[model samples]
Target: MPSRQKKVIFCIAGLLSFGCALSVAVAIGTQFWVKGTILCKTGAQLVNATGPELDKFVGEISYGLFHGQRVKQCGLGGRPFQFSFFPDLLEAIPASIHVSVILFSAVVIIFSLVAAAFFMYNAFGNPYETLHGPLGLYLWNFISCSCGCLVMILFASEVKLHRLSEKIANYKEGNFVYKTHSEEFDRSFWIILFCFTVHFLNILLIRVSGIQFPFQESKETDTSTGAADLMY
Candidate 1:
C-alpha cells in the first residue's frame, strides 16, 4: 500500500478505536445494560392473580455495573427505588463475578485507548518493526478484544446464572418473592458488543495497511525454505 493510503487506514482505525473507548465508558456509567419486568410471585399467588390481573404485580427493573433503578409492584402501586452495587447489594448478589465484569470492562477501555494511540503513532510518527509498530498494534487490539469478550461473558453469567434481576427485586423483601418476568440486554450491553466488533475490524484494517499478521511471514519463509531444499 502507498504511504498515504496506509496513513488513511491507520487514522480510520484509530478513530474507530477511540470511538469504541468513548462508547464503553459511557455504557459503564449508564443504567441501560439490562432491562426487564419482575413479578411479585407471593402477591400474585395470594390473590390468585390470573390473566390481566397479574400485570398489577409486575414492575420494572433496569441496571448497569455500578447502580440501578427498580419499580416494585405488589398489586398496590409501583414504588421506585435506586440502588448501588458497591456496598448496598453486595451481600445479595455475586460480588466476585460482578466485580470481574467491571474489571474487564475497565481493561477494555484502557486497551482501546492504547490501541488508538498506537494506530495514530504508526500513522504519523516513525515506528519500529516490533513493539512500536504493527506488532504492537496487533497486541493491543487482541488484548482489547479479549477483555471485551470477557466483559460480556462475565456479565451475562452474573445476570442469567446468578439470577441477578430476581435477586435485586427480592432483596430485603421478606414477605414477597420476586421473579423475573421478562429480561433483555439493553443499549449499554449492546454497546460493548459493538465495541468488540470494532476492535476486530481494526485488526483487519491493520492488515489492509500492508502489515502481515504476526508469524505469517515467518511461516511463509519456512515454507519457501522447505521447497528450496526439495528442489536442491
Candidate 2:
C-alpha cells in the first residue's frame, strides 16, 4: 500500500482502539453484566406454588463487577436490596475469581489505550523499530484482545461454575433459600466481547496497512539474504 493509504488505515485502527477503550471503561462501571431471576425456594416449597403461581416467589437480580441491585421475592412482595463486592459480599462469593475478572478488565482498558497511542504514533510519527513500531502495535492489540477474552471467561465461570447468583440471592437470608431461576449475560458483558473483536480487527488492519507479520517478515529477509549471498 502507498504511504498515504497506510496512514489512513493506521488512523482508522487508532480510532477503533480508542473506541474500545472507552466502551470497556463504561461497561466496567455499569451494573448490567449479568441479569437473572431468583426463586425463593423455601417460600415456593411452603406454598407448593405451581405454574404461574411461582412468579410470586421469583424476583429479578442484576449485577456488575463492583456493585448491583436485586429485588427479592418470597410470595409476599418484591423487596429491593443493593450490594457491593469489595468488602461486603467477598466472603459469600468467589473473591479470587471475581478479582481476577476485574484485574483482566482493567488490563484490557490499559492495553487498549496503549494500542491506540501506538496506532496514532505509527500513523503520524516516526517510531522506533522496536517496541514503539509496528510489532509493538500487534503486541498491544493482542494483549488487549487476550485480556478481553479472559474477562469474559473468568466472569462466566464465576457466574456459572461458582453459582454466583444463588450465593448472592441467599447471602444473608436465614430462613429462606433462594435458587437461580434464570441467568444470562447482559449488555456490559457483550461490550467486552465487542472490544475483543475490535482489537482482533485492528490486527488485520495492521496487515492491511502493508506491515508483514513479525515472523514472516524475518523469514523473507533471511531468504532474500541467502539468495543474494548465492549470487555473489
Candidate 3:
C-alpha cells in the first residue's frame, strides 16, 4: 500500500474503534448520572429525592446509547415480539422493534468481518503491512480488547442501579415490579465481557482472528531480492 492509502485505512481503523468506544462511554457515563431509585413496594416508598434524580440520569443514558431508534423488544405482545429499547425510548417506538435490532446487528457483524478480512489479507503476505508482521498486531489486539471495556462500562452502570438486580432476585417471590431496563440482555453483559477477554487473548496466540498462514518462507519458496526490501 502507498503511504497515502495506508493513511486512509488507518483512519478507518481508528474510526471503527473510536466509534465503539464512544458508544460505551456515553452509555456508562449516562448511567452514573441517572440510575433510578429503588422503591420498595407493599411496604414503604423510599422518599430519597436522589432516587428520581438518579433515574433521570439512567433514563437519559439508555436513550442516548440506544439512540431513540425503534428496535425489537424482547419477547412479548404480537408475533412474540414488540418495540423495545431502553425504557426511556420505549415510547419512541411502536408496534415492533425486535426484528429491527436483529437485522441491524447482522449487518454490523457482516461488515465487521469484511473489514477484518481486508486487514488480514493485506497483513499476511507483506511483513511490513501485515499488522502482526511489522506494523504491529498488538495495535489491532488493543482494538479488539477495547470491546470488553464496553461491557464493563455497561455492568458498572447497572451495578450502580440496584433496581434491576432486585427485580430478578424477586422473581421467585410473588412480589414483582416493572423494570425500566431489560433484565435478560443487561444481565448477560458480564458473560459477554468474559468472551471478549478470551477472544482478545486468543488473537495474540493465533495471530489476528486465527489468520494462520505460512510465516517463514521455505528455501524453494524464497522470493526475497535486495531491491524489494527497499522501503517506500
Best by lDDT: 1
lDDT of 2 by residue, 72-157 (tens): 99988999999999899988999999999999999999999999899889889999888899889989999999999999999999
- Candidate 1 lands at a TM-score of 0.95
Off by over 4 Å in 2: 228-232
What C-alpha lDDT values do all the predictions have?
0.95, 0.94, 0.37
In terms of lDDT, model 2 sits at 0.94
Number of clashing residue pairs in every model?
0, 0, 11
* Residue pairs that clash (backbone atoms under 3 angstroms), model 1: none
* Top candidate when judged by TM-score against the true structure: 2
Lowest-sum lDDT 10-residue window in model 2: 208-217
TM-score of 2: 0.97
- In terms of lDDT, model 3 sits at 0.37
TM-score of each: 0.95, 0.97, 0.34
Clashing pairs in 2: none
lDDT of 3 by residue, 35-116 (tens): 2322233222233325443332121112222322112121221111121244533333331332342333333333334334
